[model samples]
Target: MTRSCVVSVGLLLLAVSTLTYGQGLLVVTDPDQVVRLPRPILIWPPDRPVVRPEPPAAYKIKQLEVNARLLDQVAQVQVSQSFTNTGSRQLEVAFLFPLPYDGAIDSMTLLVDGKEYPARLLKSDEARKLYEQIVRKNQDPALLEWMGTGLFKTSVFPVPAGETRTVSLRYSQLCRQHDGLTDFLFPLSTAKYTSHAVDEVSFRVTIESAQEIKNVYSPSHSVEIKRPDDNHATVTYKTKNEVPTEDFRLFYDVGKGKVGTRVLSYRPDEDDEGYFLLLAGPKIESKDNEHQKKTVMFVVDRSGSMTGEKIEQARGALKFVLNNLREGNLFNIVAYDSEVESFRPELQKFNEETRKAALGFVEGIYAGGSTNINAALRTALAQLQDSKRPSYVLFLTDGLPTVGETKEMQIVDNAKEANDVRARIFAFGVGYDVNSRLLDKLAREGFGQSQYVRPNEDIEDSVSRLYRRIESPVMTDVTIEFAFDEKHEELGKPVSRVYPKGSFDLFAGEQLVVVGRYKKAGPVKVTVRGSVAGEEQKLDFPAKLARHSEDETAGFIEKLWAVRRIGEILDELDLKGKNEELIEELVKLSTRHGILTPYTSFLADEDTSIRDTASNLRRADRRLSALAEPSGAGGF
Candidate 1:
């Protein structure tokens, strides 16, 4: 008797596996022997061994290639697989393919070595019976995952020893849509079927829409996306010599407005709240006049500790920013040591002459004197007089404050007092000598982020990368409000615990993803307000909160929300003093989600009881306090 390979395809689930291995196996079966016997020979007879005694070199997957074309809500997918047989004996194999549970497939075709193969489709009841028979005979629970799906069975085929066979399957179906975004998923979790790693795996998807595409994102894998135009995009991912652990998923939205918004929600139980993800982005292509003018102040440190290569790199980074400023943007430079100096007393228009003089000023800056972070921030904030425009302070430092007003809290307070225009302060700590907690607080209060450069990294590269993201700001001081419909006003607050706690700016060619929780399921109105070119602009979008979702495809939203919420709690514990409530929540979330942090890794122990909240809190406190502060480029 020969082993058989079963390929199951259905809504949100696709798998290829051998009868011996269960979920994702590809093997060979003798159809004549299976039909002539009272019981199918491929059903794992009682006399045969359940598990293979050794690695099955007879069958192996060499390469898997997936290509999909998504047009609006419809997707055309093609999967090609190559199988190599290394056994000494010739084997006959029958191929079985499954269709989606909904049976919404418009068309499907199967090919073997470019020759068409006839296939018979089995209904759900028949497929379920066959799946259960195999599971009961083999005592393999993994096969149960595909029991409810339909099946397509093909005739027998022969594979000689030391040869390869190629199979291709193509189908088209209407994709699932939530809010304004379209979702596409492909199953690639093949790590358990075979002992040897797959040689190669590649996935390419092309998306085309009638409306302009705004956001294209994949939370499972890091993918490279190319947008040829506003309406077309290509996403590609490839790997070599490895087995995949997760499926491939993608979400994208299309709209005609200057800025597009999308929301996705998932709830596991009817009595509990739901998790939601909000995506927003500006148009990919915008005219020069559509760009919002911004005011930029570069605050650099020239302390004596930065005399050699550090000072040179800082100077080069300043030049990069000066050269990239837009024509109408407002700009100024402030360099500080023990005494603070300015390129100009006030902000100046970014014209050719002003840019030239700014370049000269940057070149003249050299390292000397002590560090005065307090005075540097104050001087830079004073120049941001235009409250209508988006303002930023690129504060760079490489050492602890040693000059006047060296207290960390005092400097933070001083900067907050002087920032009357609400200018965002992006702190760049070049090395480890600086206090990370202080920088984090500054950025948090200033509505910006903190970045650190390692000893081996280039300062110019780090600064330039950040500059590109903010160069074409389309909106600033962004805020989102979610409201219930008239009938659902009793729900009270529609959403809570949104990450990125304060207002954020939106830039062209960049997408912002906000995650939160919803109190009830109903129709809701989402309003986005931001300042555009010194004027307030508002955009409204209507969305729905899901009543309940058992769909595995929607499961990512819950995990993503949990990951982000855990991060926020960790950051709070790092900055503020330890709190028992925060620690308890952290342990619970970590244990439930299987998220392992340095302080919560003990949850992996079998004896660790998640219900013992008090013990877990004490453990977290002891672990966190015992860990010494990081010395190098490490920071929260």
Candidate 2:
């Protein structure tokens, strides 16, 4: 027999619940407030067939909207969700909401179709018993993820089949802060419980602070961020007909300084080493005279292979850089083929007249001879004469070195010798024909980064986008050091294995995140040093490493550190050739952190046992054998 019944939950209130990470069953919000509920399910007969039973009815979410306003560390959030029952039978539904393991809400309100509902709040123990009952009867373990948290329960009312329901939830909470950064997180992983993909989803958060906000970043999802002023900013993420796989997390820091730095640390176990993330950025507002002066050299490859559309895009990229050069900046261009040629004999000061002349020079250039990467790099690096001025070599090429000094290591050594002023060389490999290993080596040894452009991609867009990010150089040759108290010095180095490995540059409107490991927990002094124009500048801040394991909110720090460390190891394997030690470390990290890479993807198989070290090593060995050939573009 088929049953028909509809249960409408009245107002329910939950208090002192610990908020943690789990699959969000149902989240409803209005234009300005947010509320979340665990997925509701229909109660089936106990005697139903075990194998061929009919599928249980489920509600399909049509739309979801979340809006929040954060002032200082307090957040007011609103959520609205519209859903419809997909089955013909009317079913009684019970809604449950899971809170964070360490989170609490100050106040909350719920509404259905503009009418308030009166609901009862359950204490943690009572909530646990109710969750246990549901799990025992339904033979489902999903609710076990939120067993420890308190829940809100309500009396069921009648709702006709095929009718849509709009529910809204509003709440206020205090946000957590680590070091100087404030974190905001929302649970959006909803695909597991819903009947169909959410038709629409939108999230908007506005942050206001009394102090100037320095760094605002989201590592989980790609979001659009706008800073109306130093103290106020808005972050937004929207999607259509898609199910979100991960929760939304954002970290922002506020302070006043020419350069601001913040640190986030996570120690899962006190006995094990902890991971740390350091964020540093320049002030948003600076006077025109305060802007640091720098030198830029664009090295373009004009070979026979770049004769068609490639050459035109290269010319356009040069024009973009030339047009964006600042008043006090010094700039030049080096175009190369079988031989090297320069726009000027020396670096010229950026001015209207020089820019116009340079544009004309770019127009007259044509592609004909073979690629001489060695001569081009040397000529460009030699032009950087002022050590005090921040210098850059924007090297572009589309083919392997066929002319002078074609050997990869020798070319790298020649450029290193010529770069007397220590200019940063950013290498752009234009197409598959380019030797990615050579470009990567040149950039790595020259203290810059290598970027690859596929045949179908636009070289102009790739170069112009990067130029925009580093347009306003604030500091050059940046370095960071962590120091502990004299008593703690006996514990050995407090921090190690910092990524970016060595010195780097800082730009205005950009935030630099550095990840590493910390051996001890205590008060530590963080000192950041860099060159501003021609003078040395140093700034220091006091921070603390955690002595015990923090809550899951700080968990992302460890995962992010693992990701970067893995990247560095992979790069080493690609550039320096594979070593057993690096390979073993890669497999260990990937399996432990659940970070699957191309070489460690076997861990995803159900048959793969994470505890079997021998089997994993054998699998990794098999995968490594397939990667003997160097990657065609940049990295494997």
Using all chains and alpha carbons, the TM-scores for the candidates as numbered come to 0.53, 0.54
Using lDDT as the measure, the top candidate is: 1
Q: Write the per-residue lDDT of candidate 1 for residues 1-636, one digit (tens) a residue.
A: 000011232111111222322223444322222321101112332344445443342556677788888866556677766665566754333344443322222122233344432221222233234434533453211111111112333322345567665555555544544335676766566453444566787889999976788899997789999999999999999988776766677889876455456688988778777888886664535456777788889999998988999999999999999999988899999999999999999999999999999999999999999999998998899878888788889999988788888876678778989999888888887764666557766887788877767455688888997788677677788888899988878878899988767788776555566778987888899888887766788888898889988674555566556656776675667546699898778755544443333233210111212243222221223333322322100101
What Cα-based lDDT does every candidate model obtain?
Answer: 0.63, 0.62
lDDT of 2 by residue, 1-636 (tens): 000011112212111121111122432211111232222211122332344433344456567788888775556677666655565754333344433212222212223344433211222233245435543453211111122112232212222357555544444444545335677877565444443467788889999976789989988789999999999999999988886766677788977445445677888778788888776564534445776788889999999999999999999999999999989899999999999999999989999999999999999889999989998998888878888777888999988899988887789889989989888888887865666667767887788777767566699998997787567666778898899877777777789988767888766555666778998898898888887655688877888888776475565566556756776676667556779999778756644553433343210111212243222221233334423322100011
Model 1 quality (TM-score): 0.53
List the candidate 1 regions with Cα displacement exceeding 4 Å. 1-260, 282-285, 324-329, 349-356, 399-414, 431-441, 452-458, 563-578, 581-599, 603-636
Residues forming the 10-long window of minimal summed lDDT in candidate 1:
140-149
